[model samples]
Target: MAEPHPVLITPEWDAPATVRALCTTRHGGVSTGPWGEFNLALHVEDDSAAVAQNRKSLLKACDGLEQIQWLNQTHSPRCITADGNSLPEADAAETDHAALACAVLTADCLPVLFCDETGSQVAAAHAGWRGLLDGVLVNTVKQFRAEPETLHAWLGPCIRQPRFEVGAEVRVAFVERFVGPSRAEIENCFSAAGEPGKFLCDLATLAALQLRALGLSRVSDCGLCTVDDPRFYSYRQHNPCGRFASLIYRLP
Candidate 1:
């Protein structure tokens, strides 16, 4: 039998050979309408059976991946070690174990994948605006005992700056976290949305900034916008949409 060619995205980074990663697109599954196909998330009203089948397809695409340690993300800064069992209620997870996938589900939210230069550790974080401002990326990086300079990060599809209009409080939330010269850097992530109190936020840029702030120099972005790209799911574009999965694991 021929291998199924489901639409998957590989990160463009100089990661070690043992680290494997991919992001699923909304194609090649048994879902219908809003969920379309390949909807891996179960919390978005997608059919349970369809979600199961889609998840199975994802695992198949990973080849030897034993299991994807899924998280019940709540836009918090909590991160846990990926143990291959027990779905933890956290926004990020990391693991140094081979064949154990650390994964996160996202529609418009930014999904960041991490791995060290030696491929001994890998992690995935779901960073919505709230989670980003709350330090989810920082928490994920902290899990790896390796030096931050030795890590590589990949920023996945998310709502772009032009479409991510946020209230003044959203801008304030991030700005309040920085001080002096650093405040200007965080403030640059937001631009006026033409409304009095609204601003356009670049989620990927913000995530990259966070990664760089943690001493990670090699950060690459997929540059795919979930809201503008038809291949991926976008909650901002389709209200009751499903989520795509960004997963990373080590090869044994």
Candidate 2:
């Protein structure tokens, strides 16, 4: 007789009072089977009606959101300003409008939330390896009207290094571009996996390094690994899995 209260990860940072941010875990929704509770994405072909209800529960939890400006994330370096209209094909979305949440969905990949010191703007980005290496966070930072020092970024749950094995090429692609002190930092992001020509990559560390390079000293990480943490969905664990969302917005 009562709606399931969705379990959300609220960022514990020094963001302004008006700035609100949250990440959903795989708890408290109507989807059955592998989706098992709060799955918010509609594109995975989980029953459309169930997904719709999950979203509705999400909406109820936020209450008064004009819209959750969602993107059709494509692992590209694309970031856009959310207009509260149609869903755009981008890895990131930002909005200055009050009550409109900028949103991105993810399973194993990173979900990054951003807000300015003044709480006047907010953004969300989806950063898979390709998107991260291709500069999706770069594009997201560009959308901010404030200087990098005035911004705060919160990195959400993702596949951590020990659980995220990748080929040597992934390591090369990330480390080769940097040759200074930063190069060593990048190199440290990976460790040789048990198998040859493979390395365990740390997506969150890479994201933080990139963010810090972009001049955001205020970056914070939720320190959650989706694969190791049973509360969130993991694409590597189950294909066609549900996607949890990372959302941020300014209050009206």
Q: Rate the local accuracy (lDDT) of all candidates.
A: 0.89, 0.89
For candidate 2, report its TM-score.
0.96
Candidate 2 per-residue C-alpha lDDT over 1-252 given as tens digits, one digit per residue, 9 for 90 to 100: 887889988988888999889999889999988887889888887888898898888877995576888788899889998997898899999989999999999999999999999999899999999999888898999999999889999999999988999999989988875322287888898999889999999888888888888888999998989999999999998886899999999999
> C-alpha displacement of 221 in model 2, angstroms?
0.6
lDDT of 1 by residue, 1-252 (tens): 643456998889899988999999998877888998888888998899988888887887787798889889899999999898898899999999999999999999999999999999999999999988888999999999899999999999999999999999999988997322278888898999898999999888888887887899999998999988999999888889988999999998
Query: For model 1, where is the 10-residue window of minimal lDDT?
Result: 177-186
Clashing pairs in 2: none
